[model samples]
Target: MADQVLMELGDRLRVARKVEGSSGAVLASRAGVTQPTVSRVENGQRVSSVEAVERLIAALPLPPEEAERLTSMAREAYALASEGKRVDSGVSLVPDAARKLFTAASRVRGFQSATIPAPLRSSEYAAAAGADSDSGADWAKNLDDAGKSFEFVVTESALRTWPGSGESMPAQLEHLLTLAQRPNVSLTVIPWGVGLPVMPPHGFTVCDESGVLVETFTATMTLTGSEHVAAYRDAFEALAAVAVTGDEFRRVVEDVAADLTRFIQ
Candidate 1:
């Protein structure tokens, strides 16, 4: 298989600039490069030389420590690009990789049209879905830190109708309700059968300004290019816009829980 893994230099640069409130034009002006060059470099599309990247870093005006870290990241990114491809099993490694994304990000966003987000899934439901032992509160622990935010959206079909876990569905719905009440958690359910002009082919999780993790049946892909991250971020925001929440969403949960209770009884 061709190598799909990538390093996150562009994403790092873009995020650092946002944190510093520097515009592309401003960074370009400071770095002695055109805005297009700054844009391209931050998206990891093109850079003429390592010296140019150094100039871009200097433009960020990062403190000495941060600048050095970014320089090292740029080198790793260049190395990865040169190699072009790496293949890994990714099953065992995904959990730790996900943990890293969680710990590093202050904000997280997720979209799942077919199932619940892992962070909000009940232990039993997670197990039913063949998720790792890391579920329920353990998943929440991934977000247990200062200044963290989680926004997740799932289709109504996924939220209320988990198959193969008739007994666990109620508890999972209740768990969603519980997470919905938390200050830092925003759980939205898009109504069943809502027409979306563009339905996402697969679920994805975005970590703050840098990372996007896409889950497949066999492996999880950690995406790093700034352009790709930006695209995922835009998709997340678009989905979040139309999702149902607040009391309306609560009522939907209640309805589902009642239905589940009747079925189990």
Candidate 2:
């Protein structure tokens, strides 16, 4: 799957460069990368980093929509490469890999500082935020699997940040409240004004004890190293220690939803 995606992305890049009448050397120069790097990318081989792929895509004269699409594809390809059955799965890009991990894991631990965890997101919220609604649907089905367990700790800011339209937030928050009722799911919120021993710069998801998916602005990294996964697991435990659950968690969601309703009105 990763190879196919990369090949398709490479084809798109090659075609785009051809359409612009730019040679690989010229395109590499414009992108501030070597010609070989450009060739590697054009041939569907792995490059140095996601940033490198982004630079190549940016150097092209494609439309904004096209550029964004290609960039997304590149991220997914890199993600899959990192998670492939290699000894070094550290810091690779792929949202699909994360989804697969989530689906296969018996336990999922997630900590989000800026947005709702993907599994708990409502379809409307996911669509409005440009997130993969199919992932949300997949998670929704998984939530009913009694053998699987999910634990999430989200910040108050994440709950309050309106990724969708004004009215949509209320529904999203309500959705969270509903999901929190599940016996196998544990949803907690770290409200504002709470002092923390540590601050995680980004969100991450740990699938059982095997892998950790770290979310970043430009790419998603799948870390399979024991030490890296252990570090993230520790961070999650620290965050969860300070987070509110049960009725307190419900109060936070309701308060945010009410505030959003009044603001919209």
Candidate 3:
């Protein structure tokens, strides 16, 4: 998959250079980088450091507002890369470039306040929770196709309360168990027994590469900006740090299901 963030960064730089009517050598000389670095950056094959970006922005002689936007986008790309995350920066709710990235990209990192990621929501859970909007018939099928992988972190209480999940709860638990074993998915549970050392951040989804989708009670917000994406990426990584994975994590999920089984009896 193309690194959308980097590609955007490069495209922005090339545009700015063109608008300023400067050659690559001119920009490089002013930015203190080599002409080749400028060339590669314009081509999206190389990324400039944050400091270098600042220099490039200054050298672009772009209007102050345009320069800041360019630098901001570049910084976002660097931040994601530094954190070991990749972004295509093109994700969207519709069948566009972004949506294509969503389906084709290999990895997506996410954190949810509720149990189970949106794509994994059972038909019952989705209907009860009213999450069926925007995400259509392709939702479940897309996730199941499996060229993409996911790392999801959720709280244990999320599992305990599914408002409309009655008989579906058992199937839901079993569904999670099955998904957790899939090579493409990594599920982590933050058990109820532990307390967070700090106040928790809101939940967000880092769509493969450069997109972040966050929803509040009122409406949903999608962030394609680099800094916003980086912030959510950091947030997910922090939450994952405290989560339990592997056999112990699987056992926790199973125990929840087992308790539910007894409750059912």
The candidate that achieves the highest lDDT relative to the unseen native structure:
2
Please give, for residues 85-139, the per-residue lDDT of candidate 1 as tens digits.
Answer: 4433222235567667766888899999888887887778877777864434566
Candidate 1 residue-wise lDDT at 176? 83
- Candidate 2 lDDT, tens digit per residue, 71-110? 9998987787677446554656655776677788999999
TM-score of each: 0.62, 0.64, 0.58
Runs in model 1 deviating more than 4 A are: 1-95, 133-137
Off by over 4 Å in 2: 1-89
Off by over 4 Å in 3: 1-101, 197-201, 262-265
Residues 55-120, candidate 3, lDDT per residue (tens digit)? 877887678888778777777776666674556343344424334445665677777766456666
Compared with the true structure, all predictions reach lDDT values of 0.73, 0.81, 0.69
Better of 2 and 3 by TM-score: 2
Ranking by TM-score: 2, 1, 3
- Candidate 1 similarity to native, TM-score: 0.62
Query: For residue 215, what is the lDDT in candidate 1?
Result: 77
State residue 238's C-alpha deviation in candidate 3, in Å: 1.4
Clashes of each: 1, 3, 8
